[model samples]
Target chain A: MVKISDEEIRKMVIARLEITPSKRKIIIGGAGAFTKKELIEKIKQHDPIGQKIIEVHLNYLRSFKKQQFWG
Target chain B: MIITRPNHDFATKYLFRWSQTVITLAKKRNILVIDLKGKRASRVELTKSVRKNTADFIFINGHGNDDLVTGYNNQILVQFNDNEKLFRGRIVYARSCRSAAKLGKSCVKKGTRAYLGYTDDFIFYSDAASKFLGPSNLIAKTLLIGETAGQADQKAKDAYARTIQRFENSSVSEKDRELIPYLQWNMEKQVCLGNKNARLKI
Candidate 1:
């Protein structure tokens, strides 16, 4: 299998997030609710929250690879 | 038992509402509860309540960072060095973000019996509030029933695992499957510090 880069995984994460309903909101700590569009913008900027989102998605993918479903 | 519910914003509103389950569970057990809701969830009020009541369990629901946990209007309630000492000899379960990393440690170092919290952001969606709160609420439920702090933490993590498994099932919807990453993040971030054997006086 060809190795996938972080940027590729990041784009895939963004694409996955695109399917999220606009009305649905993701609340992160005290920052309150963030719309999908706003989260996409954050991902593009690669800010702290964006990096966190990327990490969350990547970790979820890695879990399947490692067969570590629960910790 | 003392619980702080700060209903100031969208995030806190959900916390405030979900924390009622904990309060109800405690009340059902006939435990003496000193609930500080809304404006009463302030620094001065929390100090006074802790000093006077000496409640064995402190359940705080609010937004927080590594160094401090806030209450109503994001008012600083208990900070790392400022008021963490107030929790000495007590078990605290802060349903806030990142407090376990710093403040929880300080509380333990200051003589707190146990501290259960998340080391990073506690993320959840509005529609799936119960899914997140269920595991969190389990900590208090198990503790109130004579389980040790460590046992309670493990039970909560087990609950999180079960919930995550359900969402990962092949028959589950895509929308629900999307919540898996956040749930796993929360499960990974949850941490238990201090004496795991610590139990509430009740």
Candidate 2:
């Protein structure tokens, strides 16, 4: 089972969200890149590739607030 | 602009809705919009449309990875290698995954005026009920509104900032407010390559 670390989440999620504009990688796409779950599993199996897990979930979470506003 | 929107899955359903929004907005400006929506959004159609050279901009929404973007039911629409030349002499904004990583650059090298997308996965949050109608729509709309690619990109970033502010200051639960980080991640991941100076002709 693949698991993302807390610090990794902090950097990719927390820092990414907190900063208005953050520096990021600029490499273009390659053929058949891994999905969210696939990337996680790969990372779990072989501790290579420092790729971030953000690419895995295209829009993983879903929510609707009670304010009746469009989420 | 040529847009490909495949609406087979949950995420794609939202993207298809967003693509329609783009169509409506583009039509308002009297822009000739060629949309490969739903079932029509196949690789064959995409290649055929490009061969016709009928448009100078492309805005695609669907599932993709580093070098490939799929259409209906995750059918491989366009991937790396010789296919990127399909974008030559045009501006492209792929709302897919890491198409920008290599495909975006290759498109530029092959003569695409500008390419806008994430060097990684292009993620966004949407209401499950309302689907894809979210701030994610801002970037595509801003790009097709006849603004410079760079300017449109800036506007998209600004819109993201505004949305972030909205979520942060809202009284919603921490669970409901969980989208801020993902929103921020998309902003950071979204990238522009090629001539930053490129823009669509109105």
Task: Please give, as one word, the docking class of candidate 2.
Answer: incorrect
Model 2, B82-186: lDDT tens digits are 588788888888888777888788778888898888876554433421211344566667767767888767777777667656776768555335555456567
Model 2 DockQ (Cα-based): 0.07
The DockQ of predicted model 1 stands at 0.68
Off by over 4 Å in 1: A1-4
lDDT values, one for every candidate = 0.90, 0.65
Against the true structure, candidate 2 has what lDDT? Answer: 0.65
Task: Say which docking band candidate 1 falls in.
Answer: medium
In each prediction, how many residue pairs overlap at the backbone (N, C-alpha, C within less than 3 A)? 0, 10
List model 1 lDDT by residue over B146-181, tens digit each: 899999999988998988899889999988888989
Chain B TM, every candidate: 0.98, 0.90
User: Could you list the iRMS of every candidate?
Assistant: 1.9, 11.0
Best by TM-score: 1
